[model samples]
Target: MYAGNSFEDEIAGLEEEGLRRKLAALPGAGGKLTIDGSEVLNFSSNDYLNLANDPRLKDSAKAAVERYGCGATASRLMAGDLILHEELDMRLAGLVHQQAALVFPSGFQANLGAITTLAAKDGIIFSDELNHASIVDGCRLARAQVHIFRHCDLDHLEGLLQTHQRGGRKIIVSDGVFSMDGDLAPVSALRQLADRHGAYLLIDEAHALGVFGRGAGLCAELGVKPDVVVANMTKALGSGGGFVAGSRDFIDLLINKARSFIFSTGLAPACLGSALKAVEIVEAEPELGAELLRRAKFLRGLLNEKGFDIPDEASQIVPMVIGSNEAAVEMSGALLERGVLITAVRPPSVPDGTARLRLSITLAHDEGDLHRATEVMAAIALEAGVL
Candidate 1:
């Protein structure tokens, strides 16, 4: 038998620190879910708009599969460029008010492609300290000079920009809505900083798309256009893929130079078609977006009333910081026992000593769900000394 002592020791360390992650099967859709053979009210998903189970998207996916086989068969550079993919690109570009867009297999790949392709070896990248892992890895892959600024601190970002202004191409990157914190980025401020420094700004809208700016994104809502926009169709769009939208030249460059886009198989046709239908729904039904925001606000208010120390953000993602990792894990278990499914986010996903439960609100959750979840969470948190 093969023995891996180092791997086992590392896993043991993780378990001792309450940072070990185990995958639980989620058999049902968002909102209501079945996990580990138990039904629970799921507040751990990223389906902010609750379109993951929509009949229209299902129908669109079925039709696309029938029309254009199941798989892309090859990369876009070869045989994977389906008409549905082109349609998604066009629609996404229009949504973000960009001149063009390119789809990738995932949001991770999209960020990797956009950042690594745009920021070359000699380029300088200014990234938010709390930016997603994808952006962090992308910067590393680019082999560029990366300066991480304090999260949402424009002054620190400007200082870094000024310090690095004398060199090669500069790229400023951030997430529109921080996935864990659920806080909005300073898009307008970042835009101004980019303009002042003559740098390119790339905003990842994975959590902001379909939930902000009438489903366009945070940049659109703030009335500021970045040099490039990256978004995931899997979250609010209820589809599976990511896309980068920007100037025609920029997108063409990515097509030619982005290894992630060129080497990886193209996005499946079903995902493209379903996302297309999702875009149409978002465009036609403004109420969906409005309702999402309302529900998020309501959930935040409930958490606040219970003294959970939730952030006063407008986004659908809410985090309850339970400083101790062990406490956070125990609280998550208690909540699960109470029929609520909120995952404990610990180190690596979050900063050390800042373990928390990341709560995601969805349009599918009614007022009743919100009330029950908050009540259960509050009781558990109080018992565990987390509130």
Candidate 2:
């Protein structure tokens, strides 16, 4: 029904603006990987604890497959609610200090379900501007009056909340740690505002889990509890699923009204097995998150000393904001050529004119690895005129 090459023309426009994307087939895992038959220090992964390939997680998954089989075979409401699912739900809730939890097929689905169910028609939602795309999309689908406050600006949020005094159900949502900038949210302040406004608070800890608060996330670190806590096992948990933790009543409401969860198949058995093991590891060794933070600080200091103007954030994600998409991509390519791999993050993932290279540190890297990576990164950045 459309003219030929319409998609091609759109893609060509993206290419011209340096926004084109392609999948790179990087082999292996962890902090060091083989790309194009050469070994490179990997700085683009979310495996903060390097547990994705751990033998314990793998063995747990294998044993689960043998015992419970591979698939859930139906939605949780149907015949798919296994004992493993219930166990993960309980353990994850305990980890976040919540009374109950519900698992979804993915983190995106969790957000979609929680947000839409919490704030329905005639409701009001106050959300952070820099929240992840999943949260953004959830807000869109909520059918509520959505107000986006300035990123991490509590005053702005309060102003918006004050203006919307006659709300049906008011909810405030934000990311625990912003994915691109790696800055932590002011969870305590946000919680205070929510309490003052009589609003339910939701925090997505997708980036902070297993890397902060001894694996419980930013809310736990700040001693601020929200109405809902959202996170995923795919990242630091080294598995594949997302969950929402809250009071037992709220979780029961989600089970009844969250369309995404009600319709989707239950999470696979392998993911549950591996994630259960990952959670246990974090619980046993709470220092893993602290050690990762220490490494992040070390890396940030090294880059700063080398004349790079990365933010002095405590999180493992380090972003070098380049003004142009072309320049950001060029810097990423240059770094790869020099045996270090940091992905170029461009517009839509970040704001326009703020394209960047996001460097994620993992436990697989050490002081020596960070130092070597810093040297290579500095050389490439200098060549690209970013230093």
Candidate 3:
């Protein structure tokens, strides 16, 4: 029996650096959560539309279970692809205004497949500096040369494209909405740049789907069609899976060449059913996203009024930088003790010296909830000498 003493040292090192992570066994989802039997205002969740616990989504999941049973049983190519999977594929394509879509087990896998398949060995990938970890990993997995441009800096990206100009494939990838900063990408400008450089544009709408473009995503909202759109069902859609939408030919290429999708099991039927229903609801009530943004603005205003340095981004995610790892952890714990759940985000989730409280505004949080949480946060900051 080998006791890994090296792992023990690594664990101790994490704790000393205030980077150790532990799981909290919360009973359910949504804006209000019970942490150890005490109800708290949950601002740490990513369910921006509050659909995770919605009755309609639950019923859809139940129906899917009764119809298709539990697991996928095998890889999609090995007979696990069901009718529900096909329906979800079409639904997601329509939702993002693409010619086709291919579903994956998760958003991470979707990115791993899309980027690797699109950028060949001779190609180059110019990605945003602050893109999601999944995209970063995808770029690494691909054999293509990857050059990272400054975040949302079009001039830097154009310079990279020009410097690395080649006849082989060129792909520019970015997040429609940065998860940590909660800022939108310049989608329209990126589209123009891709056209000018004869490159393919890929935008991950993981944070913007079901909350932007009347649920069609940020690209659709801006009428800027990228060569490929990568997104997830877990966030605002209130389900579990991922999908990549693009032209029919591009999807076919992914089907043939993407190792992640080729080797992985098909998305589960329950997730497919629930995600389909979530898309339907979003289509029927486009205002749901608008109203959620409105609430976010109201809450941001409240936090700003309390003297917290909240950015003026329109996305539901609002971050409050607390500087040091220990102080951020202390602030999060203080908020939790005061019945507000805002988990602290530290490196490498964020950069060093930028530890923050990542507040995700969901539809479940009302005006009263926002007011009370900010009041509590401001008081805690003052006590900690942060205000």
Candidate 4:
């Protein structure tokens, strides 16, 4: 409870190691943003469909506020469960082709709730090594026997499952699209393993919702239904909340047992309303998802032609794997100076010596924007010997 400059010293150490973080004042929206008082072409956002400032969503939010006021004054279990919340839950379940769904205040809380509730003590949770921090923490909170398989290594996962088959309530968890590496998990293969090993599978589709599978997600795109699916409305839906979808019984269990859900206040009306409209838009306009994938492929091709270390993928997320923390920070600063807003992802967000720039593409980015961004990034990468 008592410390003398220890917190300051730790922060200074983080600064020295290029691990310190600071918030930038970003005032505007979409691909072009007003960051630090300058108009920059932003590639750092997770708004895959560029719907954050969508007029339709704004109108829906406005209507919701007029009807339901601002905040959810109590928890969902108490007095905060509005009719809109029930409608949203039903619509979300329909979106994922699940029997039921439950909403949380944020994606992190959703993961924490789902994982901790499903895989409790006396369970074995097989997690991907590069799963999101929320999933990592969820596994820890579950207090289960956790086994981490190599990222996307189906054979390794199978081996671990085979060895741990005779266990109590086995669970396999992975990200539909890894946040940092910008690579997709092998959902089909994982599903097969789960089926064979009598284990339940959970896929966190935080980064894959609006940009994949006709706006359903990676699991839907691949025709592999997981036992549990968690997603964030903030990223693809351009709203603020998270959801868990699965069988009716599973969702009911979570509603009863998940402390994060039962204890926290319900999602605000504005977010629920905006997200409802966003889901409708995503489902009604399938072309938006296709266009997002096309842009991602185009960007990957452009960066690859320039000899940057980007993976060949069709998802809207692209990673430029820069090896050093200092180099990543320097490159991020240089890009900002050049009127581009790409973030430098360093250690803890990524593994050691695998720092990167997590470039994200959205429906708002056009051919010209992609060309200009790639040119600037290629030049900087070449100068820094990162290409």
By TM-score, the better pick of 2 and 4 is 2
Superior by TM-score: candidate 1 or candidate 2:
2
Over all chains combined, what TM-score does candidate 4 have? Answer: 0.97
Colliding pairs, model 1: none
Task: Please identify model 4 stretches exceeding 4 Å from their true place.
Answer: 1-5, 35-38
Task: Give per-residue CA lDDT, model 1, range 355-385, as digits (tens).
Answer: 9889888887899999999999988877876
Give one digit per residue, the lDDT tens place, for model 3 in 281-360: 99999888889999999989998898888889989999999999999999999999999999999999888999999999
lDDT of 4 by residue, 206-270 (tens): 99898788888989999999999999899989999999999999999999999999999999999
Clash pairs, model 3 backbone: none
lDDT of each: 0.90, 0.93, 0.92, 0.90
What is the alpha-carbon RMSD of candidate 2 to the true structure?
1.2
Cα-based lDDT at residue 116, candidate 2: 93
TM-score of 1: 0.97
Q: What is the lDDT of residue 219 in candidate 1?
A: 91
Clashing pairs in 2: none
Model 1 alpha-carbon drift over 4 Å, by segment: 1-5, 34-39
